[model samples]
Target: MKTVVIGFLGSILDSGGGPGRWEKWRPSVSICQHDDLVIDRFEMLHSRGHIRLAEQLRTDIASVSPETKVNLHVCDPANPWDFQEVYGCLHEFARQYPFDLERERYLIHITTGTHVAQICMFLLTEARYFPAVLLQTSPPRKQGSGDAGAYSLIDLDLSRYNQIGARFAREKQESTEFLKSGIKTRNAAFNQMIARIERVAVRSKAPLMLNGPTGAGKSTLARRIYELKKSRHQIQGEFVEVNCATLRGDAALSTLFGHVKGAFTGALSDRAGLLRKAHGGVVFLDEIGELGIDEQTMLLKAIEEKRFSPMGSDKEVESDFQLIAGTNRDLRLAVAEGKFRDDLLARINLWVFELPALRDRREDVEPNIDYELDRFARDNDVTVRFNAEARKEYQRFATSPAAVWSGNFRELSASIMRMATLAEGGRITTDVVEDEIERLQSTWRPKPSQSNLESLLPAKALAEIDLFDRLQLDVVIEMCRSCATMAEAGRKLFAASRTRRRAVNDSDRLKKYLARFNLDWAALKH
Candidate 1:
C-alpha cells in the first residue's frame, strides 16, 4: 500500500555528517509513515559495501512482504555539495527513482562525519520537502553524555515540523520561515481554552486538570502555557509528560520523583524524575485517572508539600512543578467505586476544565478541514482543491452521527492526511472521502462471519483487546455501516495488517481475507 525507498548517504566518515542527538529523541516523527519506515542508525556504513547493504536491506524489506518495494538512495559527501545542493540531489534522486519515490523510499544516511550534514538532511526532509517517502536513521547508543547519537527518522508534516521550527526559532533567534509558512492560525474555542488557563496562571496555583481525549490539542495547550510563562518569568524548567497507564507501582513514584542510584533493578545512575525536570514549568500527566491509590497518595504529598524522596534515598528532593493533568476517563465514577483516592481527586479537581471533542465542536469542522487540506497540500508540494461535492461529502461525514471519532482530533487529522495523499486532480471527492472513511473503519470491524471468532479467543485476549482495539474498531465500523460497495473496507483491512508480523504471507492473501472479514489493521492492533 506504501511505496518505500532505502536512502544511503555515504558513511558518516565519508559523507561528513548524518542525523544526531536531539532529532532522535522527539515524538514528531510519529506523524509520518510510522508503520512502513524503519530508521537504522549506524556509526559507520556497514563494511558489507554499498551495493551489498542496499541489496540486504532490499532483502529485509522483501522478506517482510514480497510486494514491499524498497529503493536505495546513496548520498556521497565526496561529491562536494552544501546542504541545499544535497537537498537538490535528494529531489533529483526522488524524481529519477519512479518506484517508491513518493511513499516508500526511505532516506538512510550512513555518515558519521559531522552533525552539520545530518542537520541538513533533517532540515531538507522535515523542514522543507515533506515527502512521505523519506525515513531518516537513528544513531548508535552513546558511550558518553556528549556523544550525539544518530538522529531519529521522522515522517514530519507541516504542523509537527513547524512545532520543531518554532522551538528552535524561539530558542536560537532563527527566522520565521519554518514556523509560519503553512499553518493557518485561528482563534477558536481552543484558543479560548488557552486564554482561560493563562488568566488563572498566576492567580491560582491549584493543579489544572485538562480533560480531553489524546491529541485534542491538550499537549499543545500545555506547551503554549509553558512558553507563555517562560517568556514572562525566569522559570527554568522543561515540560514533561507521563502516561499514567504506563506508570506502574514503584516505577510511577520513581518516574514522578527521581530515584537515587541503586534505587531499583534498572537504576544505573541517579536520575531526575519528570517532576524534578518540570521544576517551574509544567508536568502534563495524561490519563490521570489511571493512577492507582498508592500513587495518588504520593502525588498528593508532592503537590501539597513540594518535597519527595527518591526511591532508596533518605534525603527528600524539593520539586516545584506546576501540574497540568489530563484524562478521558470518568474520575467521578472511579472515585465513587473507591478505585480513586478521594483526597487526591479533591486536590486535582480543584481547577478542572473539560476539553470538548472535535465532533462536539461541529461548527469548527469545515474550518479545521480547510486548514488541514491547505497544510497537507503545501507540505507535499501539491495543490489539492475540494470540489463542491467533495466539500459537502467531507462536511457531511464530519457531522454524521455515524462518525464516532473515538480518538478525536488525532483520528480526524490522520484521515484528512490520507485523503489528501490519495486525492485526484487536486480536487477531493466524495469517493476519496468514502474510501478514507472506510479504510479507517475496516481496521476494527470484523466480517459478518469472523464475528464468530469472538467465540474462539480466550477471555484474557478478548479483554486485553477490548479497550485498546475492539471499541475503537467498532467506532470505525459504525461510521461506514452504509457502504454500498466493499472496496473501501478492502483497502483499510489491507493497510491495517500489512505491517504486522502475523499478517498473512501475501498482500493479496491478506487483502482477500480482509475483504472476507471486513476488518483492518487498526482493529487487530487495538
Candidate 2:
C-alpha cells in the first residue's frame, strides 16, 4: 500500500535560506527522510504566491528520498485566518481529489499551516471528508544535532482505541441511565427513545416537545434534560419550570413575559418573569397545550425572536433560553378546535417525543418499582424492602393489564411510598401488597357516569369508540338524561358557544352530534 501525506507548505520553515538550508529540519523534507515512516507521495498545498517555495521544498524532499513523489496544489484563501474561506478551499480540494482508500493510506499534515487551516484540516478529517489520520510534526529536542523532527500520527477514529471507545460507550450508557432515573427499564422502545433523547439533548438547543399523558414523566424528563445540558456546560442560568395549565388570562402573560408596575389591577411592582429567569438556561412549559391562544401567540414570538414585551411595557426584554414544552393533550387536536395556535405548535414541534403511557410499558413497571423504593429510602432515610412473596405478587399485578396505571410513574411512585411507609420492620409483606393492590384498583375503577354508559351502550360499540370519544359521549348522555327537553340540554351544553354566535341553533347541533352515535334525545333520556 502507498503512503500519502497531504499538507500546507510551511513557507517560513521550508525556505531554509540559501545553501545552509539543509542544516535545519523542515517538516515537509524531514517527513520523507524517515526510513521507517516512508512517504510514497506528498501532496503539498500552498497559495499561488508560494509556488516558488513549494517547488524548492518538493526538490529538497526528492533529494532526501528519491523514491517519494511530490505533487503541488494551489489552495489560496483571501485570508488565511478566515475559517469559512480556508475551510471551503480545503473542503473543495478534498472533494475533488481522488482518494484510493483501498490502495493508499492518507495522513493530513497539521504541522504546517495557520491555526485556522489546521483546525479545518482536523474537522475535515474528523468528518471523514478526508479518510485519513492527522500528522503533527515537532522540532527535535536536540535542535542542532541534525536530528530529523519528531512526528506523531493522531487517528480520529475512536473505534481503533478499545479503551477510549469503551469509555465513550460507558459515558453514553451512564447518560441514558441518568435520563431514565437509573431505572433498569426492560421496554425496548422506551430505552431506544431515551437514547435518542440523550443524543438530541446534548447536540441541539432547539425547542423540544414531550407529548404524553399526564404523570408519564414528561416534566421529570424535561428536568433531567435541563440538568444533563447544564452538566455539559451548555446552560448557565436556572431551570425555570412553569405549569401553563395553572396560568390564566393576564396572569399567564405576566408570569411568562413579566409585567411592568401597574400592568394589571394587582400590579404593585415590576416583575421579571419565568422566561427571563431562564435566560442562558432552559424553560420547561408543562401542559403547554393548556396555554390560552393569546399567551400562545406571545410565546411563539418569544421562542422565535428570544424577545418579548412585558405587560404594560413599550419595550421588549430579551431572554435567550432553550425551550422544552410538555403536553398530555394533543396540540394538533387543540389547534383544530382553535384552542392552540398552529404556528406555535409548528415552532415547538421540531423535536417532538411521545412518552408511552405506563400501561403501554408494562415490562418497565418492575424496574420502576425498585427505583421508587430506592428513592423512598433516600428521601425518608429509611431502608424498605418487600418480602419475596409480596414483591412477586406486586410485580404480577403491576405488569398485568388489570393495572391501569392511569397516573403512570407518579401513581407508581405514590404506591411505593405508601407501601414503604406501612411496611412493618422495613419489610412489606403479602398483606401489605394485597392492600396496596386493592387501593390501586379502587382508584382506577370507572366513575358512576362511565358505568352508566357501559350499561346503556353495547359492549362492541363501546370497544369501537376511542376512550376520548367515549368519555365525551358519556357526559353528553348524562346531560340529556338530566334535562327535561332536548333544547334545554342543548342550551346548557352549548352555552359557551352561544355567546359568540349571532344565530345559535344549539338544538340542531346537538341533534347532529347525537345522530353520529346513532341515538336521539328520547332514546338517550330513557
Candidate 3:
C-alpha cells in the first residue's frame, strides 16, 4: 500500500541557503527523512510565483528519500487569506484527485499554509473530501540540533476513537437522565422527548414553550432545564418563575415588567419585576396563556428586544434573559380568540415540547413511584418502601385504566407521600396501599353531570347511536364541556387534522359532525 502526503509548499519555511539546507529542518524535506513514516508520494501544491521554490523543495525531498516520488500541482488563490477562494480551490482539487482508500492511505499536511488554508484543509478532511487524516508537523525545539522535528497524525473519523465516541454517548445519556431528575423512566416517547429537550436546553437560548395538561410537570421540567443550563455554565443568573394565571390587570404588568414610583394609585416605590430580576438568567412563565393581551404585548417586546418600559416610566429597562413559557391552555386557540398575540406566539413557538399526561405514560408510573419515595425520604428524613405484594398491588392500581391521574405527577407524588406517612415501620403494607387506592379512587370519582352521557342525551336518542359513535361523542361532549367556546373545543378535537388542512374551518367541521347526531355545541355544554 502507498502512503501519500498532500500539502502546500511553504514559500518561507521550505526555503534555505544552498548546501546548508539539509542542516536546517524543513517540513517538506524533513517529512520524507522519517524512516518509519514511509511516504511513497508527496503531492505539493504551490502558487505560480513559487514554481522555482516548489521544484527546489521537490529535489531536496528526492535527495533525502530517493524512494519517494514528489509531484507539484499549481493551485493559486488570488487571496490566500480569503476563506471562500482557498476552500473552493482546495475543494476543487480534492474533487478532482483520485483517492484509492483500499490500496492507499492519504495524509493532509496542515503545517504549511495560511491559517485560513489550514482551517479549510481541516474542514475538507473532516468532511471526507479527501479520505485522509491530518498530519501536523512542528519545527525542532532547539536550533541546529539536527533534529528531524516531530509529526503527529490526527484522525478526523471519530469512530476510529472508540473511547471518544463512547464518552459522547455517555454524556448524552447523563444529560437525558439529569433532565428526568435521575429517574429511570421506561416510557420510550417520554425518554425521547427528554433527550431532545436536553439538546435544545443546552444548545438554544430561544424561548421554549412546554405544552401539557395541568400538573403534568411543565413547571418542574422548566426548572430542571434552568438547572441543567446553569450546571453547564450556559446560564449565569437566577431562575425566576411566575404563574401567569396569578397575575391580573395592573398587577400583571407591574409584576412582569416592573413599575416606577407613582405608576398607579397604590404604587409607592420603584419595583424591579420578574423580567428584570431574571436578567442574565432564565424566567419561567407558567400558565403563560393566562396573560392578558396587553401583558402579552409587553412580554413579547421584553423577549425580543431584551428591554421594556416600566409602568409610568418612558425609559426602557434592559433585562437579557432566556424565556421558558409553560401553558395548559392551547395558545393557538387563544390567538384565534384575540386573547394572545399571534406574533408573541410565533416568537416563543420555536421549540415546543408537549409533556404527556400521566395516564398516557403508565409504564413510567412504577419508576416514578420509587422516585417519589426517594424524594420523600430526602425531604422528611424517613425512608419508606412497599413490600413485594404491596408494591405489586399499588403498581397494578396506579397503572390501571381506572387510575385517571388527573393531576399527573403531582397526584402521584402526593399519593406516595400519603402512603409513606402512614406506613408501618419502613414498609408500606397492603393495608396502607389499599387505603391509598380508595382515597385516590374517591378523589378521581366523577360528578353525575360529567360521568353520565345519559344526562346529556335522551335515552331513546342515545340508544339509537352505535357504541363506537357513542364513545366518540362522549369524548367530544367532554371536550366541549371543558372548553370555553365551540371554536376552542373544535380546535382540541381536530388539532391534528387542522394542521394538515389549514383552510378547513375547525368549528364549522365540528358543528357539522355534531349535527349528524341531532346535537349542537350549545346543547352538549348544557
Candidate 4:
C-alpha cells in the first residue's frame, strides 16, 4: 500500500476551529491509505508535538513493517498551483510502480481542504485511476486535559458503481444469469411457464402479465422473460422498468407516451416516453394495479396496437415494445371493481407466472444467506467467515416465525447484515439473533391499556385485521405496550405471513389496507 501525505501543513486556523481553544488548539487526525489499517489518530497526531507527528507516523509504520513506504508529498493550501503540484507528485509516485493502463490503482487523497484535490487527482490519474476509494476522516477534536479524538469517518468505494449496476440487473433478472439458472429452479409448478412465455413472446401477440404476492419476485421474473427474449433469442429490444405507483395521471400518460415541447409546464423539449425508448425492448410496468383508470385505457390500447401518440402531438407514434406488467393485486377483482380495465386484463393475461416467496423455499435460505454474507464481506474488504454457530443462528432466524421474510430475499439480506454486525468473535450466536428479533418485536408489541380486541381491528376496516391479531396483541400487551396504529400491528402481523394466498383481484382492497396499515407483505415474505 502506498501512503501519500497531501496535507500536513496546518496553521492556527486549520488546527483549531472550535468556539474556544486552550491546550485543545492543535487537534490532529490521520486517514488510512486502505480500509483495513487502523490508525490511533488521537495518540499519534494530537498528543505528540507538531514537529514529531510525521516522524512518529514513519516510525510507527516502520515498527509494524520496515518495507512500508511513507512518502511526504506536500500541496500548497492556496490557488490552482496547489492542485498542479499535487498532480506532479502523484505522477512522480506513479512512476515507481509498473503502469498497467487497464488495471485500476488507488488514488488516496489525504487532503480535507477541498473536493478540488480529489477531482484534480482523479482527472490527472486518467484511466490509470482504477478502483478509486474515497474516505473523509473528521478533523480531530480535543476535550478537557486530554488529546484529540477522531470519529465520524465516511468511506465510499466509487469503483462499486459498475458492479452495483450489474448486480441490480442480475437481481432484477435483466441479465443472462436467469437463463443460465434454468427455469426449473423457479416455482416447481411453473416449469412449463417459460415455454408458454416463449410462444407468446415470439408471436408478439399478447402483453404479458405476472401476478404474485409482493415478495414473490414478480419484477425479477419479468426481467428473466426480457433477458430470454432479447439475449437468448437474439430479439432486438430493450428492457425498461417503470413503477406505476410513481406515475400519477398526467405524469403517467407523459411517462408512458412521449411528450412534445410545451406539452406541459415542464416540457422544455420533446421527450420520448418509456414506450418509445423501449421500442425494440421490453417495457416493464411494475405495480400495474396502481395505474389510474385513464392510464389503464391508454396502456390497453398501446398493448393491443403497439402504437401510441405523444401527450401533446396529434400524430400517432409507432413503438414495438413488448409489454410485461407485474402486480401483487388481482386484476380480475380490479376490473370487476372498475379500477383496472377488463379489456387490458384480457390482452395481457395470456402468460402469467406467480413467483414463490423465500419462506416457501426455505431450502434456499441457508445458501442465500451465505451468498449474501460473502457479498457483504467482499464489499467491506473483510475476510469474513461464518462459524457453525453463526450458520446455526442464521438457520434459526431463517426458520423462525419472525423470519417469515415477507420482503423475500431483500429483507433476508438486510437481516443477515444486522446479524453479521452484531456477531461476537466472528461467530454469530443465538444471543445476537435474539437481540435483533427482540429489537424488532419490541417496537411493534402493544401495552395493556391498548390490548383490547377493538384496538386490534384495522383502522381501514375491521375485516382487514388478520388472524395474528390476538397473538400479537397479547405479545404487545405482555410487553406493556399501549396504543398502536393498525399500520404497526399490520407490519408485525404480515411480517410472518409467508403462506397466505395473495388475492388476485382486490387491487383497491389491497392498496387501501396496505397503505393504511403501512404493511409491505411482499418485503416481509421475501
Candidate 5:
C-alpha cells in the first residue's frame, strides 16, 4: 500500500553539521531511512519563515532517496501557540485535503510541528477528521552513532488496547453524567434520552427542538446543553436566551434582529440584537411556538443564511450561531393550523426531543425530591433534612396518579422551597409535607363551581369512556357553559381547523361530538 507522510519542517540548521552530511539526521529524513517504512509521498508543511530550511532538507532527502517524491505545502497559522487558531487552520486544511483512504495509508508526522499543532493534529485524527495514524520520530541514541533515530506508529484506534478502550468508555460515562447535570436519573427512558442529547450536543450544530409541557425543564435543559457545549469547547460565544412568548409585534422584531434608529416610535438607538450577541455561541428560543409568523420568517432566513437585516434597515448583518428552540405547543399541529410556518417547523423538527412531564415520569419523583432538597440546601445556605415520614409522604403523594403537577418542576421547586422555609429546627416533619401536599392539590384541581358541571353528567356515562375521551368532553362542556350559544362555542373551539374547510358547520360538528357521549345540546342547555 502507498503511504503518504504529512508533517511540518523544523529548522534544518540545528542538525549538527558534518562532512558528507549522511552523518547528520533530520526527523523527516530519518523517518524515510527506516527500512521497513516505505513512503510514496512526503507532504512537508512549512511557514514562510522556514522556506529555505525546508528546501535544503528536501534536497538532502532527495539526494539520498532519488525515487521518493517531496511535495511542499505552505501553511501559515496566525499564532502557532494558540490552540484554537491552530486547530481551526488544521481543521480547515483537513476538510479540503484530498485523501484516498481506501487505496493508500496516511501518516501524520507529529514530531516536527509546534506542540499545539501536534495536539490539534492528534485531535483531528482521533475525531476522524484526518483519517491517519500518528508517526513520531525520535532522535538518535548517541551523537556519533551511525544509526538514524527511531520511528513508531501510534494507532489511536483504542479498541486495539483493552485498558485504553475501558478508559475511553469510562470517560464517555463521565461526560454523559456532566451533561445530565449530575442528576442520578432512575428511569431507563430518561437516561437513554440524556445520552442521545449528549451525542447531539457534541456532534450537531443544527437547531435542536425541545417540546414538552410548561415547567418540564426545557429552558433548564437548554442552558445545560449550552454549558456542556461550552465546556467541550464546541462553542466560544455567550449563551443568548430569550422567551418568545414575552415578545410581541415590533418589540419581537427589534429585540431579535435589532433595529436602526427611527425604525419605530421609540427606536432611539441601534441595538445589536440577540442574534449578533450570540455569534460563535448558542441561541435558545424558548416557547418558540408562541412567536408570530413574521418573527418565524425572519428566524428561518437567519438560521439558514446566517444573515438578516434589522428592523427598518436594508443592511444585512451576519451572526454564526447554533440554535436550540424550546416550546410547549405541538408545532406540527400549529403548522397544520396555520399558526406556525411549515418551512420553519420542518427545519427545526430535524432534531426534535420531547421531555416527559413530571406526571409522566412518576418513577423519577423520588430522585427529583432529593435533587430539589439538595438544591434548596445549597441555595439557602441552611441545611434542612426531611424526616423519614415526611420524605415518604411526599414521595407517595407525588407518584400517585391523582398528583397532577400542572406547573411541573416549577411547582415542585416552589413546594420544596416552601417546605424548607417552613421547616422548624431544620427538620421537615410529616405535617409540613401534608400541608404542602394539600396546598398543591387545591391549586391543581379546578374551582368547585367551574368543575361542578363534570358532576352534572352521569358518572356511569363518563366512566364508560376512556380518560382521553373524557377530557375532550370536559373541555367541550366547559366551553358550552361559558358561551351564550352553542354556535359560539363551536366557533371558538375549532376556529383554526374551520378555516381549512370549504363549508363551515361548527354547530353541527359540536352537536355530533356531544351526541357520541349520549348527550345533546338541548339537554345540556336545560
Candidate 6:
C-alpha cells in the first residue's frame, strides 16, 4: 500500500544559493528526501500566485524519486489569518482531493504552510475532515554531510500521549459543564450521567428517552443536546419541538403526521407537521407519554420505517431524523394500562436516562440561581444584583430542609424572576428575598388536614417522608378516610383504571400503597 502526503508548496525563492541551491534545498524537495520516510505520493497544494515556484518544486520533488506521484492543487485564500476563509478554502480543496484511506495511508505535511494554514489542516484532520496523521519536517541544527532535516509523524488523537490525554480530559469536563449551564456540581453521579448523555448526543442517532418529573430540565437538556449536535455539525436541520401533552385526537394526528388539504373538518390548507419539518435533524417529543394511542402507533411506524403517510394521503413521506422523547410520567405504566403502545416504548427504550428533580439535587441550586439571574438579565435587559444579606438569605432557604421546591427548578427560576422584578434600584435586598420566601412557603405548605394526617402516623413513619412524599401520602389518606372500606378506597383511587389493570386486586393494591408509608389500611381507616 502507498502513503499519500498532503501539504503546501514552500516558495523556492527563499533558498539563498541561486538556482542550484533551489534544486538542492527546496523544503518541498527536502521533505520528499527525508531518509527514513518513503514517498508514495504528495497532494501538494499551492496558491496560484506561486505557480512557477510550485511547478519547479514539484519537478525537483519528482526528480528525487520517479516512483513518487505528486498531485498539485491550486488552493488560494484571500486572507490566510482569517480562520473562516482559510478553513473554507482548504475544505473545498480537500473535497476535490481523492482520499482513499483503505488503499493509501495518509500524512499531512505541516512544515511548509502559513501558521494559519497549518492550524486549518490540523483542525480538519482532527475533525476527520481530513483523516490523516501530521508530518513535521525540521532542518538540521549543524551542517553535516549526508545529514537531512528530520521528519516525525504526529497523531493528534491525544490518547497516544499522557499530557494531551489529560488536557482532553479537561476539555471533556468543560463540555459537561457547558451542558450543565455552567453549574460546577459536586454530585459525582450527576456529572457522570451528563458525560454519558454527552456521548449519546454527539455519537448516536437512535431514539433517546429522558424520564423525569417536570422542571427537571429535560426539555432544556434536549435543547442543549440539539445545540451541541448542531455546533458539532452532527445535525444539519432545525430542532423541531412538540409538547405531545398539548395535542389531542385529530389535532395530534394532523400536528405530527401533517395533513393534506381537506384532510379533516378544519383542514382548509396543507400542513407539513412537526415531524416532516424535522427532516435530517432532531424531533423532541416532550411529554411523549401524553400522546394518544393512535398517534403513538403512527409515530412508531415513522420511527422504525423512517417513512409515514400524511393525514388523508396514501403516499408516504420520508423524514430522516433522530428522536428524543421526554416525559415525567411512567411510560411503562402507561404501556401496561394500554394508554401507550408497548412496542413504541421498546423502540425508544434503548437509551433511557432519568434527569433528577431539582429538590433532590439541592446542591446544584446555588449555581443555578446565579445562572437564572444571568438569564433574566439577558432577557429582560435589567441587571439585578442580590445584596450580600439577600444572597445569603436566599441560598440558606433554598438549600434548607424546610424548602419545598415542589415545582423544582421551574419554581425556583420563577422565584428568582419575581425577586429580580420587585428588587428596588436593581438591588435584591433582604426584604425582596423574604417576600419570595413567604410566597414559596404559602405555595408549598400542606393544608391543615394533611398536617393532621401526618400527625396520625408513627414518628418513624413521619421520618420516612419529606414534604413531597407526605403531600402524595396525604392525598391518598384523604381518599381512604372518605371511603367505607379499603376496597372502596382502592376502587375510588384507582378509578376506571381497574378495567385496564391486569389483575383485580383492589384490597392488595391499597394495602401496598399504605405499606409504602409504613401505614396499614386498618390503621388508617379504623
Candidate models: Cα lDDT each: 0.59, 0.88, 0.89, 0.57, 0.83, 0.82
What is the total number of backbone clashes in candidate 2?
0
lDDT string for model 5 (374-456, tens) is 88888888889899989988988988977888778778888988999999999999999999999998887788664534666
Show the lowest summed lDDT stretch of 10 residues, model 3: 444-453
Order the numbered candidates by lDDT, best leading: 3, 2, 5, 6, 1, 4
Candidate 2, pairs of clashing residues: none
Candidate 3 Cα outliers beyond 4 Å, as residue runs: 11-25, 48-56, 59-63, 66-68, 100-104, 266-268, 446-526
Ranking by TM-score: 3, 2, 5, 6, 4, 1
Q: Could you give candidate 3's per-residue lDDT for residues 405-459 as a string of tens digits?
A: 8788999999999999999898999999999999989987767554446777778
Q: For model 1, how does the per-residue alpha-carbon lDDT over 1-526 read when each residue is reduced to its tens digit? A: 3433333423422221134522332211211223544433211222234555445444433543454444444555443346666556555654554453444444434233235455555565665453542444443365323333344544656575787778855643221111212233343665455446656754565788877656666676666656655765745688888889898887887887778899889988998888888887778888888888877887888999998788889998888888888876556646765878888888888877767666666666666687777778779888887779877877887777767666676777788888888877777788897787787667545577654336434556566664645655554454333221133334444566656646444434533444444554333322
Question: Which model scores highest in TM-score?
Answer: 3
TM per candidate comes to 0.49, 0.78, 0.83, 0.50, 0.67, 0.62
- Candidate 1: where is the Cα deviation over 4 Å? 1-195, 374-383, 424-430, 441-526
Scanning candidate 6 in windows of ten residues, the lowest lDDT window is 12-21
Q: Which structure is stronger by TM-score: 3 or 6?
A: 3
Candidate 4 Cα RMSD after full superposition onto the native fold (Å): 24.2
The TM-score that candidate 2 achieves is 0.78
After the best TM-score superposition of candidate 2, give how far the Cα of residue 176 lies from its true spot, in angstroms: 2.1
Which scores greater on TM-score, model 2 or model 4?
2
Clashing pairs in 6: none
